[model samples]
Target chain A: AAGVIQSPRHLIKEKRETATLKCYPIPRHDTVYWYQQGPGQDPQFLISFYEKMQSDKGSIPDRFSAQQFSDYHSELNMSSLELGDSALYFCASSLFGAGGPYMYQETQYFGPGTRLLVL
Target chain B: EDQVTQSPEALRLQEGESSSLNCSYTVSGLRGLFWYRQDPGKGPEFLFTLYSAGEEKEKERLKATLTKKESFLHITAPKPEDSATYLCAVADTGRRALTFGSGTRLQVQP
Candidate 1:
């Protein structure tokens, strides 16, 4: 089974710079969620998209924005990077309405996270 | 606000030892409860999802049971490979994002 794919598995940037992280979700999965895991902390929800539309938002910083493309892939764009922005970024995908007792609830499969370091 | 709390910040076990990890959660309306295993520096691997109280699921040496307010992950005859952080997360009704617990770090020794 093909899993979610993330690009630029490792990244480094200086303060005030810009970075973009890309994620390719699993085939046929219509929902994509992004999360940030800081050192010694649990994963925090950032944002999510469904069918090219912004479905939900969490604690994502104002300096950061994300979008899902027509291909069902998504990207997280960060600007004026700060050292505190360094962390592991993960992308998870799930299929909604896949017939089941709980059609709205689906299992999310995660991709190998991208490690971002801002200096 | 949805909240998840996992107990025993860390655990150490010898090979073949059996134990259980606990996760207590509070949500306005329950959508799903999820268990994931995460290796250091890697993304969380999906384990199980329990939707309602009295629900149970199992895989290999692991079993998960859920109630109205909490869940348990029981590991039986564990091996060193099972060493990792176990995370519990919940989705509330109409919410697309998950609220995660701090996780329980398990160290299995040979």
Candidate 2:
């Protein structure tokens, strides 16, 4: 079975250009999450989607937005990318709403990541 | 505000050396805590999750322990391949988003 998959493993874009990253969740998972990792830093929560709706968002600027379609795939869009937006973007998926204490289905499985460079 | 802090920003250890990394956190309610290992140019891979105080989990040469205020990842006689950044996170407050620490970078030299 294919785990989470992200496209364009590496991307280089000019400032003010829009960048779109895609993610396909596990075969049957229903929740997708996006995270950003800066150099020498830990991954930061960007946003999460469940049942085709956004469940939560972190402290990101308005330039970043995400959408989930059909419960199996998601897309992260950065409009007018800034230099600060250069980072590794990771996509994760897990079973839907399995968020309690004892269930492992809710455990996140991460994709390799998409390295974005803004120049 | 929920926060997670990892100590020693970086560590350099030789093969066969045993050491530990620390993750201290402060949150409103204790939902769960997690540990992940990330190689260069890769995303984090989940290692373990601790739900409450006094919880412990082990995998291979790595052991994770949790307390009310902090968690620790202990490496036993590590190998060079164990070199990677270890991150700790808490999923409780701030809209159920995970608050991560600036990870501990470990370099194991052979």
Candidate 3:
């Protein structure tokens, strides 16, 4: 089965530079989520989108932004990058039912993840 | 805010040794509890989802149980291939995204 796909499996960046990571969700999945896992740390939720609309926000930094397109693919864009932003950035997809009224209550399928190393 | 805490940060077991991992959580609305296996440098692989208290689910040598305040992942028997980080997470009615625990790294020696 085709799983969630993420671009640039590994990324290297200098301070203050900008980066964009893309995700292709499984066919027919309606919701996308982003998470960051620091070395030896737990994964933290960044944000999510449902039906191409921003659905929820977490501890993401102001310099970071993300969007989901009509095709159900999503992107995570980071600007003025700091070294602290270096981590494993991962995306997960699930059937629509995340928020109000439409909670499908399904498990999320995750991508292989993009490792970011900020210098 | 919803949170999850897993115990014994790390565990080591010999092949055929059975054990269990603990996951304690606090959430406003317990939508679902999840278990995932993560290999190094890869994303988490979905394992199980337990929705209600006293619920139990099993696959292969692994079993998951949920209660009002926590969950447990039981590994029966042992194998080197079973070694990996087992993560616990919960989806709350408050949000669509899941709040994950720090995870327990397990190493099975053959």
Best by TM-score: 1
> In model 1, what lDDT does residue A72 have?
98
User: What residue pairs clash in candidate 1, if any at all?
Assistant: none
| Pairs with steric clashes in candidate 2 | none
Q: For model 3, what is the alpha-carbon lDDT of residue A25?
A: 98
Expressed as tens digits, the lDDT of each residue in B9-93 for candidate 1 is: 9999999999999999999888889999999999999999998899999999999999999999999999999999999999998
Superposed Cα deviation of residue A114, candidate 2 (Å): 0.7
Q: Write the per-residue lDDT of candidate 2 for residues A14-98, one digit (tens) a residue.
A: 9999999999988888888899988776888899988898998886679988899975699998999999999999998887556
After TM-score superposition, the amount by which residue A87's alpha carbon in candidate 1 deviates from its true location, in angstroms, is 0.1
**Candidate 3 lDDT over residue span A12-86, tens digit each:** 999999999999999999999999999998889999998999999999999999999989899999999999999
Per-residue lDDT of model 3, residues B4-82, tens digit only: 9999899999999999999999988898899999999999999998888999999999999999999999999979999
TM-score order of candidates, top first:
1, 3, 2
Q: Candidate 2: which stretches are off by over 4 Å? A: A97-105
Q: Compared to the true structure, candidate 1 yields what TM-score?
A: 0.98
Evaluated on CA atoms against the true complex, candidate 3 attains a DockQ of 0.75
Give native contacts recovered, as a fraction, per prediction: 0.76, 0.58, 0.71
Give the Å error, residue B91, model 2.
0.2
